[model samples]
Target: MTVPTLTLNDGKTIPQLGFGVFKVDPEETERIVTDALEVGYRHIDTAAVYGNEEGVGRAIAKSGIARDELFVTTKLWNDRHGADESKRALGESLEKLGLDHVDLYLIHWPTPENNNSVETWEAFPSYRDQGLTTSIGVSNFDHRYLPQILDTGIIPAVDQIECHPQFQQIETRPLLTEHDIKVEAWGPLGQGKVDYADTVIGEIASAHGKSWAQTIIRWHLQRGHVVFPKSNNRDRMAQNFDVFDFELTTAEVAAIDGLENGGRVSGDPAEVN
Candidate 1:
Protein backbone atom coordinates (compact mmCIF):
# COMPACT_ATOMS: atom_id res chain seq x y z
CA MET A 1 0.00 0.00 0.00
CA THR A 2 1.26 3.48 -0.82
CA VAL A 3 1.01 5.95 2.04
CA PRO A 4 0.46 9.57 1.10
CA THR A 5 2.96 12.25 2.15
CA LEU A 6 2.39 15.68 3.61
CA THR A 7 4.60 18.53 2.46
CA LEU A 8 6.30 20.41 5.24
CA ASN A 9 6.95 24.14 5.42
CA ASP A 10 10.64 23.41 4.80
CA GLY A 11 9.70 21.65 1.53
CA LYS A 12 10.22 18.12 2.89
CA THR A 13 7.64 15.32 2.67
CA ILE A 14 6.47 12.98 5.48
CA PRO A 15 4.32 9.89 5.31
CA GLN A 16 0.84 10.62 6.59
CA LEU A 17 0.69 7.36 8.52
CA GLY A 18 3.69 6.47 10.72
CA PHE A 19 4.65 3.82 13.25
CA GLY A 20 5.08 5.04 16.84
CA VAL A 21 7.16 3.40 19.59
CA PHE A 22 5.94 5.39 22.54
CA LYS A 23 5.74 2.69 25.23
CA VAL A 24 7.15 -0.36 23.51
CA ASP A 25 9.58 -2.18 25.75
CA PRO A 26 13.16 -1.44 24.75
CA GLU A 27 13.91 -5.13 24.37
CA GLU A 28 10.90 -5.58 22.09
CA THR A 29 11.48 -2.46 20.04
CA GLU A 30 13.68 -4.01 17.36
CA ARG A 31 11.41 -6.95 16.72
CA ILE A 32 8.27 -4.82 16.59
CA VAL A 33 9.83 -2.07 14.48
CA THR A 34 11.16 -4.68 12.09
CA ASP A 35 7.72 -6.16 11.80
CA ALA A 36 6.27 -2.72 11.02
CA LEU A 37 8.84 -2.03 8.31
CA GLU A 38 8.30 -5.46 6.80
CA VAL A 39 4.58 -4.73 6.71
CA GLY A 40 5.21 -1.57 4.60
CA TYR A 41 5.40 1.21 7.18
CA ARG A 42 7.98 3.73 5.97
CA HIS A 43 7.75 6.24 8.80
CA ILE A 44 8.87 5.58 12.38
CA ASP A 45 8.31 7.98 15.26
CA THR A 46 10.48 7.58 18.33
CA ALA A 47 11.72 9.91 21.03
CA ALA A 48 14.72 10.18 23.36
CA VAL A 49 12.32 9.73 26.25
CA TYR A 50 10.87 6.59 24.62
CA GLY A 51 14.23 4.89 25.31
CA ASN A 52 13.83 2.82 22.13
CA GLU A 53 15.80 4.79 19.54
CA GLU A 54 18.68 2.33 19.72
CA GLY A 55 16.34 -0.56 19.09
CA VAL A 56 14.65 1.28 16.24
CA GLY A 57 18.03 2.03 14.76
CA ARG A 58 19.10 -1.58 14.96
CA ALA A 59 15.88 -2.75 13.34
CA ILE A 60 16.18 -0.27 10.48
CA ALA A 61 19.82 -1.14 9.92
CA LYS A 62 19.09 -4.85 9.86
CA SER A 63 16.01 -4.51 7.66
CA GLY A 64 18.20 -3.73 4.64
CA ILE A 65 15.96 -0.83 3.66
CA ALA A 66 17.85 2.10 2.27
CA ARG A 67 18.07 4.95 4.78
CA ASP A 68 16.58 7.38 2.28
CA GLU A 69 13.50 5.20 1.87
CA LEU A 70 12.48 5.62 5.53
CA PHE A 71 11.18 8.64 7.38
CA VAL A 72 12.55 8.83 10.93
CA THR A 73 11.31 11.26 13.59
CA THR A 74 12.68 11.87 17.09
CA LYS A 75 11.88 14.52 19.65
CA LEU A 76 13.58 16.84 22.14
CA TRP A 77 12.45 16.07 25.67
CA ASN A 78 11.13 18.77 28.00
CA ASP A 79 14.18 19.01 30.24
CA ARG A 80 16.33 19.44 27.15
CA HIS A 81 14.40 22.52 26.00
CA GLY A 82 17.09 25.13 25.59
CA ALA A 83 19.09 26.55 22.70
CA ASP A 84 22.24 24.48 23.08
CA GLU A 85 20.49 21.59 24.80
CA SER A 86 17.99 21.20 21.96
CA LYS A 87 20.79 20.85 19.43
CA ARG A 88 22.73 18.51 21.69
CA ALA A 89 19.65 16.43 22.46
CA LEU A 90 18.88 15.97 18.78
CA GLY A 91 22.48 14.90 18.21
CA GLU A 92 22.10 12.36 20.99
CA SER A 93 18.90 11.06 19.36
CA LEU A 94 20.65 10.83 15.97
CA GLU A 95 23.52 8.91 17.48
CA LYS A 96 21.09 6.51 19.11
CA LEU A 97 19.12 6.13 15.88
CA GLY A 98 22.40 5.35 14.12
CA LEU A 99 21.74 7.98 11.49
CA ASP A 100 23.66 11.12 10.62
CA HIS A 101 20.36 12.98 10.13
CA VAL A 102 16.65 12.47 10.79
CA ASP A 103 13.78 13.32 8.45
CA LEU A 104 11.91 15.20 11.15
CA TYR A 105 12.73 16.45 14.66
CA LEU A 106 10.08 17.73 17.05
CA ILE A 107 9.93 19.50 20.40
CA HIS A 108 8.17 16.71 22.33
CA TRP A 109 6.17 19.00 24.50
CA PRO A 110 6.02 22.74 25.02
CA THR A 111 6.34 22.90 28.78
CA PRO A 112 5.00 26.40 29.06
CA GLU A 113 4.97 26.38 32.84
CA ASN A 114 8.72 25.89 32.75
CA ASN A 115 9.03 28.88 30.41
CA ASN A 116 11.61 27.22 28.17
CA SER A 117 9.64 26.34 25.02
CA VAL A 118 10.25 29.63 23.25
CA GLU A 119 13.99 29.38 23.69
CA THR A 120 13.95 25.77 22.51
CA TRP A 121 11.85 26.63 19.45
CA GLU A 122 14.24 29.44 18.60
CA ALA A 123 17.01 26.86 18.50
CA PHE A 124 15.26 24.66 15.89
CA PRO A 125 16.24 26.59 12.75
CA SER A 126 19.90 26.19 13.59
CA TYR A 127 19.45 22.43 13.82
CA ARG A 128 17.85 22.44 10.37
CA ASP A 129 20.73 24.49 8.96
CA GLN A 130 23.28 22.23 10.64
CA GLY A 131 21.81 19.36 8.56
CA LEU A 132 21.04 17.35 11.67
CA THR A 133 17.31 17.43 10.85
CA THR A 134 15.55 18.08 7.58
CA SER A 135 12.38 19.46 9.20
CA ILE A 136 11.57 20.84 12.67
CA GLY A 137 8.18 20.96 14.41
CA VAL A 138 6.42 20.82 17.77
CA SER A 139 4.29 18.33 19.73
CA ASN A 140 1.54 18.82 22.34
CA PHE A 141 1.19 22.44 21.25
CA ASP A 142 -2.21 24.16 21.37
CA HIS A 143 -3.78 27.34 20.07
CA ARG A 144 -2.34 29.40 22.91
CA TYR A 145 1.24 28.25 22.51
CA LEU A 146 1.28 27.81 18.72
CA PRO A 147 0.77 31.52 18.06
CA GLN A 148 3.65 32.28 20.37
CA ILE A 149 5.96 30.23 18.16
CA LEU A 150 4.43 31.36 14.86
CA ASP A 151 4.53 34.96 15.98
CA THR A 152 8.27 34.65 15.71
CA GLY A 153 7.56 34.18 11.99
CA ILE A 154 8.93 30.62 12.15
CA ILE A 155 6.11 28.35 11.02
CA PRO A 156 6.59 24.83 12.26
CA ALA A 157 6.25 22.16 9.59
CA VAL A 158 3.95 20.02 11.73
CA ASP A 159 2.30 19.87 15.14
CA GLN A 160 2.06 16.41 16.68
CA ILE A 161 -0.53 16.03 19.41
CA GLU A 162 -2.92 13.69 21.24
CA CYS A 163 -5.73 13.57 18.67
CA HIS A 164 -8.38 10.86 18.45
CA PRO A 165 -12.09 10.93 17.89
CA GLN A 166 -12.67 11.51 21.60
CA PHE A 167 -10.18 14.34 21.78
CA GLN A 168 -10.59 15.91 18.38
CA GLN A 169 -8.74 19.18 19.17
CA ILE A 170 -11.13 21.19 16.99
CA GLU A 171 -10.10 24.53 18.41
CA THR A 172 -6.42 23.95 17.68
CA ARG A 173 -6.90 22.69 14.12
CA PRO A 174 -7.59 26.07 12.50
CA LEU A 175 -4.60 27.66 14.18
CA LEU A 176 -2.35 24.96 12.75
CA THR A 177 -3.97 25.39 9.34
CA GLU A 178 -3.60 29.15 9.51
CA HIS A 179 0.14 28.75 10.08
CA ASP A 180 0.47 26.02 7.43
CA ILE A 181 1.40 23.43 10.03
CA LYS A 182 0.21 19.92 9.36
CA VAL A 183 -1.57 18.33 12.33
CA GLU A 184 -0.26 14.89 13.20
CA ALA A 185 -2.20 12.73 15.63
CA TRP A 186 -0.13 10.98 18.29
CA GLY A 187 -2.64 8.83 20.25
CA PRO A 188 -4.97 8.14 17.34
CA LEU A 189 -6.57 5.13 19.02
CA GLY A 190 -7.21 6.94 22.28
CA GLN A 191 -4.40 4.79 23.67
CA GLY A 192 -6.87 1.91 23.34
CA LYS A 193 -9.22 3.53 25.83
CA VAL A 194 -12.26 4.17 23.68
CA ASP A 195 -14.16 1.06 22.70
CA TYR A 196 -13.50 0.43 19.03
CA ALA A 197 -16.49 -1.90 19.22
CA ASP A 198 -18.78 1.01 19.93
CA THR A 199 -21.85 1.44 17.78
CA VAL A 200 -20.63 4.48 15.93
CA ILE A 201 -17.23 3.28 14.76
CA GLY A 202 -18.35 -0.34 14.60
CA GLU A 203 -21.32 0.42 12.40
CA ILE A 204 -19.14 2.34 10.01
CA ALA A 205 -16.59 -0.44 10.04
CA SER A 206 -19.30 -2.95 9.24
CA ALA A 207 -20.49 -0.89 6.33
CA HIS A 208 -16.99 -0.74 4.91
CA GLY A 209 -16.10 -4.30 6.02
CA LYS A 210 -13.03 -2.91 7.80
CA SER A 211 -11.94 -3.05 11.40
CA TRP A 212 -12.74 -0.20 13.77
CA ALA A 213 -9.09 0.81 13.85
CA GLN A 214 -9.04 1.05 10.09
CA THR A 215 -12.21 3.11 10.16
CA ILE A 216 -10.77 5.59 12.62
CA ILE A 217 -7.53 5.87 10.66
CA ARG A 218 -9.56 6.45 7.50
CA TRP A 219 -11.35 9.25 9.33
CA HIS A 220 -8.03 10.94 10.02
CA LEU A 221 -6.89 10.45 6.46
CA GLN A 222 -10.12 11.83 4.99
CA ARG A 223 -9.73 14.88 7.21
CA GLY A 224 -6.16 15.49 6.03
CA HIS A 225 -4.41 14.80 9.35
CA VAL A 226 -1.26 12.76 9.76
CA VAL A 227 -1.89 9.73 12.03
CA PHE A 228 0.36 7.22 13.76
CA PRO A 229 -1.32 4.42 15.70
CA LYS A 230 1.00 2.57 18.09
CA SER A 231 0.91 -1.19 18.48
CA ASN A 232 3.52 -3.86 19.12
CA ASN A 233 1.31 -6.66 17.84
CA ARG A 234 2.33 -7.55 14.31
CA ASP A 235 -1.15 -8.34 13.01
CA ARG A 236 -2.60 -5.14 14.46
CA MET A 237 0.26 -3.17 12.99
CA ALA A 238 -0.63 -4.55 9.58
CA GLN A 239 -4.30 -3.85 10.22
CA ASN A 240 -3.51 -0.22 11.01
CA PHE A 241 -1.65 0.09 7.73
CA ASP A 242 -4.58 -1.38 5.79
CA VAL A 243 -6.61 1.82 5.76
CA PHE A 244 -6.06 3.03 2.23
CA ASP A 245 -8.90 1.12 0.57
CA PHE A 246 -12.08 2.68 1.91
CA GLU A 247 -13.48 6.15 2.51
CA LEU A 248 -16.02 7.15 5.14
CA THR A 249 -19.16 9.00 4.08
CA THR A 250 -19.87 12.51 5.34
CA ALA A 251 -22.55 11.30 7.76
CA GLU A 252 -20.31 8.59 9.11
CA VAL A 253 -17.56 11.14 9.49
CA ALA A 254 -19.93 13.42 11.37
CA ALA A 255 -20.93 10.63 13.69
CA ILE A 256 -17.34 9.91 14.56
CA ASP A 257 -16.64 13.62 14.97
CA GLY A 258 -19.63 13.81 17.34
CA LEU A 259 -17.82 11.38 19.63
CA GLU A 260 -15.56 14.22 20.70
CA ASN A 261 -15.92 15.09 24.38
CA GLY A 262 -12.96 17.43 24.58
CA GLY A 263 -11.19 14.84 26.71
CA ARG A 264 -7.47 14.12 26.63
CA VAL A 265 -6.04 10.79 27.79
CA SER A 266 -2.42 11.85 28.11
CA GLY A 267 -0.92 14.21 30.64
CA ASP A 268 -1.50 17.88 29.95
CA PRO A 269 1.60 19.53 28.46
CA ALA A 270 1.04 22.45 30.81
CA GLU A 271 1.61 20.11 33.76
CA VAL A 272 4.00 17.53 32.29
CA ASN A 273 7.03 19.47 33.42
Candidate 2:
Protein backbone atom coordinates (compact mmCIF):
# COMPACT_ATOMS: atom_id res chain seq x y z
CA MET A 1 0.00 0.00 0.00
CA THR A 2 1.57 3.26 -1.09
CA VAL A 3 0.56 6.11 1.22
CA PRO A 4 0.35 9.54 -0.40
CA THR A 5 2.88 12.22 0.48
CA LEU A 6 2.77 16.00 1.15
CA THR A 7 5.76 18.13 0.27
CA LEU A 8 6.68 20.54 3.02
CA ASN A 9 7.76 24.17 2.68
CA ASP A 10 11.34 23.02 3.03
CA GLY A 11 10.85 20.35 0.35
CA LYS A 12 10.63 17.41 2.77
CA THR A 13 7.96 14.80 2.08
CA ILE A 14 5.66 13.53 4.86
CA PRO A 15 3.34 10.56 4.70
CA GLN A 16 -0.20 11.96 4.37
CA LEU A 17 -1.61 9.26 6.58
CA GLY A 18 0.57 8.95 9.67
CA PHE A 19 0.01 7.42 13.13
CA GLY A 20 -0.26 9.62 16.19
CA VAL A 21 0.35 8.84 19.90
CA PHE A 22 -1.53 11.78 21.38
CA LYS A 23 -3.17 10.09 24.37
CA VAL A 24 -1.75 6.63 24.18
CA ASP A 25 -0.79 5.60 27.72
CA PRO A 26 2.90 5.75 28.50
CA GLU A 27 3.05 2.15 29.75
CA GLU A 28 1.36 0.76 26.63
CA THR A 29 3.31 2.93 24.23
CA GLU A 30 5.92 0.36 23.30
CA ARG A 31 3.45 -2.38 22.48
CA ILE A 32 0.99 -0.13 20.67
CA VAL A 33 3.71 1.64 18.72
CA THR A 34 5.33 -1.66 17.86
CA ASP A 35 1.96 -2.82 16.56
CA ALA A 36 1.60 0.35 14.48
CA LEU A 37 5.02 -0.26 12.99
CA GLU A 38 4.13 -3.88 12.27
CA VAL A 39 0.89 -2.69 10.71
CA GLY A 40 2.94 -0.49 8.35
CA TYR A 41 2.88 3.03 9.84
CA ARG A 42 6.14 4.77 8.89
CA HIS A 43 5.29 8.13 10.46
CA ILE A 44 4.75 8.60 14.22
CA ASP A 45 3.67 11.78 15.98
CA THR A 46 4.48 12.39 19.64
CA ALA A 47 5.07 15.40 21.85
CA ALA A 48 7.23 16.25 24.85
CA VAL A 49 4.04 16.74 26.85
CA TYR A 50 2.83 13.22 25.98
CA GLY A 51 5.53 11.66 28.18
CA ASN A 52 5.68 8.53 26.05
CA GLU A 53 8.82 9.29 24.05
CA GLU A 54 10.84 6.65 25.86
CA GLY A 55 8.36 3.92 25.01
CA VAL A 56 8.21 5.09 21.38
CA GLY A 57 11.98 4.95 21.31
CA ARG A 58 11.97 1.46 22.72
CA ALA A 59 9.47 0.31 20.13
CA ILE A 60 11.46 1.82 17.25
CA ALA A 61 14.58 0.12 18.50
CA LYS A 62 12.82 -3.22 18.97
CA SER A 63 11.05 -3.09 15.60
CA GLY A 64 14.46 -3.13 13.95
CA ILE A 65 13.12 -0.97 11.12
CA ALA A 66 15.78 1.05 9.36
CA ARG A 67 15.92 4.59 10.79
CA ASP A 68 15.38 6.21 7.40
CA GLU A 69 12.16 4.29 6.92
CA LEU A 70 10.46 6.17 9.78
CA PHE A 71 9.26 9.73 10.09
CA VAL A 72 9.15 10.78 13.76
CA THR A 73 7.64 14.08 15.02
CA THR A 74 7.86 15.55 18.51
CA LYS A 75 6.95 18.99 19.84
CA LEU A 76 8.05 21.75 22.18
CA TRP A 77 5.48 22.44 24.91
CA ASN A 78 3.86 25.73 26.02
CA ASP A 79 5.98 26.40 29.06
CA ARG A 80 9.17 25.89 27.12
CA HIS A 81 8.39 28.32 24.25
CA GLY A 82 11.31 30.74 24.51
CA ALA A 83 14.45 30.49 22.40
CA ASP A 84 16.77 28.86 24.93
CA GLU A 85 14.10 26.67 26.50
CA SER A 86 12.70 25.64 23.09
CA LYS A 87 16.17 24.46 22.05
CA ARG A 88 16.69 22.57 25.31
CA ALA A 89 13.24 20.99 25.24
CA LEU A 90 13.84 19.59 21.75
CA GLY A 91 17.18 18.16 22.90
CA GLU A 92 15.45 16.48 25.82
CA SER A 93 12.83 15.02 23.46
CA LEU A 94 15.61 13.70 21.21
CA GLU A 95 17.34 12.14 24.20
CA LYS A 96 14.09 10.54 25.33
CA LEU A 97 13.23 9.27 21.82
CA GLY A 98 16.79 7.90 21.63
CA LEU A 99 17.15 9.35 18.16
CA ASP A 100 19.72 11.75 16.79
CA HIS A 101 17.09 13.79 14.87
CA VAL A 102 13.33 14.06 14.68
CA ASP A 103 11.70 14.15 11.23
CA LEU A 104 9.61 17.17 12.32
CA TYR A 105 9.37 19.32 15.44
CA LEU A 106 6.36 21.53 16.21
CA ILE A 107 5.51 24.36 18.55
CA HIS A 108 2.74 22.68 20.52
CA TRP A 109 0.76 25.89 20.92
CA PRO A 110 1.15 29.60 20.27
CA THR A 111 0.30 30.25 23.92
CA PRO A 112 0.05 33.91 23.10
CA GLU A 113 -1.39 34.31 26.55
CA ASN A 114 2.02 33.31 27.82
CA ASN A 115 3.43 36.36 25.98
CA ASN A 116 6.48 34.45 24.81
CA SER A 117 5.44 33.15 21.37
CA VAL A 118 7.65 35.59 19.48
CA GLU A 119 10.75 34.59 21.38
CA THR A 120 9.98 30.96 20.73
CA TRP A 121 9.24 31.47 17.02
CA GLU A 122 12.55 33.27 16.78
CA ALA A 123 14.31 30.17 18.05
CA PHE A 124 12.64 27.40 15.99
CA PRO A 125 14.81 27.59 12.87
CA SER A 126 18.02 26.93 14.75
CA TYR A 127 16.89 23.31 15.09
CA ARG A 128 16.92 22.82 11.31
CA ASP A 129 20.34 24.41 11.08
CA GLN A 130 21.79 22.35 13.95
CA GLY A 131 20.40 19.10 12.49
CA LEU A 132 18.39 18.34 15.66
CA THR A 133 15.07 18.18 13.74
CA THR A 134 14.53 17.81 10.00
CA SER A 135 11.63 20.31 9.88
CA ILE A 136 9.91 22.80 12.20
CA GLY A 137 6.27 23.94 12.34
CA VAL A 138 3.48 24.99 14.70
CA SER A 139 0.22 23.60 16.10
CA ASN A 140 -2.95 25.30 17.36
CA PHE A 141 -1.95 28.42 15.46
CA ASP A 142 -4.66 30.50 13.76
CA HIS A 143 -4.64 33.05 10.93
CA ARG A 144 -3.84 35.82 13.37
CA TYR A 145 -0.95 34.06 15.06
CA LEU A 146 0.44 32.51 11.88
CA PRO A 147 1.24 35.77 10.12
CA GLN A 148 3.11 36.94 13.17
CA ILE A 149 5.46 33.98 12.81
CA LEU A 150 5.74 34.28 9.01
CA ASP A 151 6.41 37.99 9.23
CA THR A 152 9.64 37.01 10.91
CA GLY A 153 10.70 35.82 7.43
CA ILE A 154 10.53 32.13 8.39
CA ILE A 155 7.67 30.08 7.03
CA PRO A 156 6.60 26.94 8.87
CA ALA A 157 6.76 23.74 6.88
CA VAL A 158 3.35 22.76 8.26
CA ASP A 159 0.64 24.18 10.54
CA GLN A 160 -1.24 21.56 12.51
CA ILE A 161 -4.60 22.40 14.02
CA GLU A 162 -7.87 20.92 15.31
CA CYS A 163 -9.61 20.25 11.99
CA HIS A 164 -12.66 18.07 11.39
CA PRO A 165 -16.07 18.56 9.82
CA GLN A 166 -17.34 20.55 12.78
CA PHE A 167 -14.39 22.89 12.79
CA GLN A 168 -13.12 23.44 9.26
CA GLN A 169 -10.96 26.50 9.97
CA ILE A 170 -12.64 28.31 7.10
CA GLU A 171 -10.80 31.57 7.52
CA THR A 172 -7.37 30.17 8.20
CA ARG A 173 -7.20 27.93 5.15
CA PRO A 174 -6.56 30.71 2.64
CA LEU A 175 -3.80 32.26 4.69
CA LEU A 176 -2.01 28.94 4.89
CA THR A 177 -2.39 28.26 1.18
CA GLU A 178 -1.28 31.77 0.26
CA HIS A 179 1.87 31.39 2.29
CA ASP A 180 2.69 27.93 0.93
CA ILE A 181 2.34 26.39 4.38
CA LYS A 182 0.90 22.89 4.31
CA VAL A 183 -2.00 22.42 6.70
CA GLU A 184 -2.10 19.28 8.82
CA ALA A 185 -5.19 18.15 10.68
CA TRP A 186 -4.86 17.21 14.32
CA GLY A 187 -8.00 15.75 15.96
CA PRO A 188 -9.03 14.82 12.42
CA LEU A 189 -11.81 12.65 13.80
CA GLY A 190 -12.70 15.33 16.31
CA GLN A 191 -11.13 13.36 19.18
CA GLY A 192 -14.13 11.06 18.84
CA LYS A 193 -16.34 13.90 19.97
CA VAL A 194 -18.50 13.59 16.87
CA ASP A 195 -19.97 10.17 16.46
CA TYR A 196 -18.24 8.38 13.59
CA ALA A 197 -21.37 6.30 13.13
CA ASP A 198 -23.47 9.42 12.73
CA THR A 199 -25.86 9.46 9.78
CA VAL A 200 -23.88 11.52 7.30
CA ILE A 201 -20.49 9.89 7.71
CA GLY A 202 -22.10 6.48 8.17
CA GLU A 203 -24.03 6.85 4.95
CA ILE A 204 -20.91 7.83 3.07
CA ALA A 205 -18.98 4.92 4.59
CA SER A 206 -21.66 2.41 3.65
CA ALA A 207 -21.82 3.62 0.05
CA HIS A 208 -18.09 3.28 -0.39
CA GLY A 209 -17.64 0.11 1.68
CA LYS A 210 -15.25 2.03 3.89
CA SER A 211 -15.23 2.68 7.61
CA TRP A 212 -16.52 6.07 8.81
CA ALA A 213 -13.05 6.81 10.14
CA GLN A 214 -11.61 6.11 6.73
CA THR A 215 -14.24 8.29 5.07
CA ILE A 216 -13.46 11.27 7.28
CA ILE A 217 -9.72 10.83 6.79
CA ARG A 218 -10.22 10.66 3.04
CA TRP A 219 -12.16 13.91 3.18
CA HIS A 220 -9.16 15.59 4.73
CA LEU A 221 -6.79 14.11 2.19
CA GLN A 222 -8.95 15.21 -0.77
CA ARG A 223 -8.90 18.72 0.62
CA GLY A 224 -5.08 18.65 0.56
CA HIS A 225 -4.68 18.42 4.32
CA VAL A 226 -2.10 16.12 5.90
CA VAL A 227 -3.62 13.97 8.65
CA PHE A 228 -2.61 11.63 11.48
CA PRO A 229 -5.48 9.87 13.21
CA LYS A 230 -4.59 8.51 16.65
CA SER A 231 -5.79 5.08 17.66
CA ASN A 232 -4.15 2.71 20.11
CA ASN A 233 -6.63 0.04 19.06
CA ARG A 234 -4.65 -2.14 16.70
CA ASP A 235 -7.52 -2.83 14.30
CA ARG A 236 -8.59 0.81 14.11
CA MET A 237 -5.00 1.93 13.60
CA ALA A 238 -4.84 -0.38 10.61
CA GLN A 239 -8.30 0.71 9.50
CA ASN A 240 -7.31 4.39 9.53
CA PHE A 241 -4.38 3.63 7.27
CA ASP A 242 -6.63 1.73 4.86
CA VAL A 243 -7.93 4.92 3.23
CA PHE A 244 -5.58 4.83 0.28
CA ASP A 245 -7.87 2.67 -1.84
CA PHE A 246 -10.88 4.96 -2.32
CA GLU A 247 -11.58 8.50 -3.40
CA LEU A 248 -14.56 10.77 -2.65
CA THR A 249 -16.49 12.47 -5.47
CA THR A 250 -16.86 16.25 -5.75
CA ALA A 251 -20.51 16.21 -4.58
CA GLU A 252 -19.73 13.76 -1.81
CA VAL A 253 -16.90 16.00 -0.75
CA ALA A 254 -19.18 19.04 -0.83
CA ALA A 255 -21.76 17.28 1.30
CA ILE A 256 -19.14 16.62 3.92
CA ASP A 257 -17.96 20.22 3.71
CA GLY A 258 -21.51 21.44 4.33
CA LEU A 259 -21.44 19.66 7.69
CA GLU A 260 -19.04 22.23 9.09
CA ASN A 261 -20.77 24.17 11.90
CA GLY A 262 -17.98 26.39 13.16
CA GLY A 263 -17.91 24.32 16.33
CA ARG A 264 -14.68 23.35 18.07
CA VAL A 265 -14.58 20.57 20.64
CA SER A 266 -11.14 21.39 21.94
CA GLY A 267 -10.17 24.33 24.07
CA ASP A 268 -9.23 27.51 22.21
CA PRO A 269 -5.45 27.95 22.31
CA ALA A 270 -5.84 31.72 22.47
CA GLU A 271 -7.94 31.36 25.59
CA VAL A 272 -6.36 28.24 27.10
CA ASN A 273 -2.85 29.54 26.86
**lDDT of each residue in 193-257, candidate 2, tens digit only:** 88866858889999999988899999999999989899989999989988888999999899899
Off by over 4 Å in 2: none
lDDT of each: 0.90, 0.90
RMSD of every candidate to native, in Å, equals: 1.0, 1.0
In model 1, the runs with Cα more than 4 Å from the true position are none
- Residue 112, candidate 2: how far off, in angstroms? 1.3
Ten-residue region with minimum lDDT total, candidate 2: 193-202
Model 2: residue 142 alpha-carbon error in angstroms: 0.5
| Candidate 2 lDDT score relative to the true structure | 0.90
Overlapping backbone residue pairs in candidate 2 total 0
TM-score of 2: 0.98
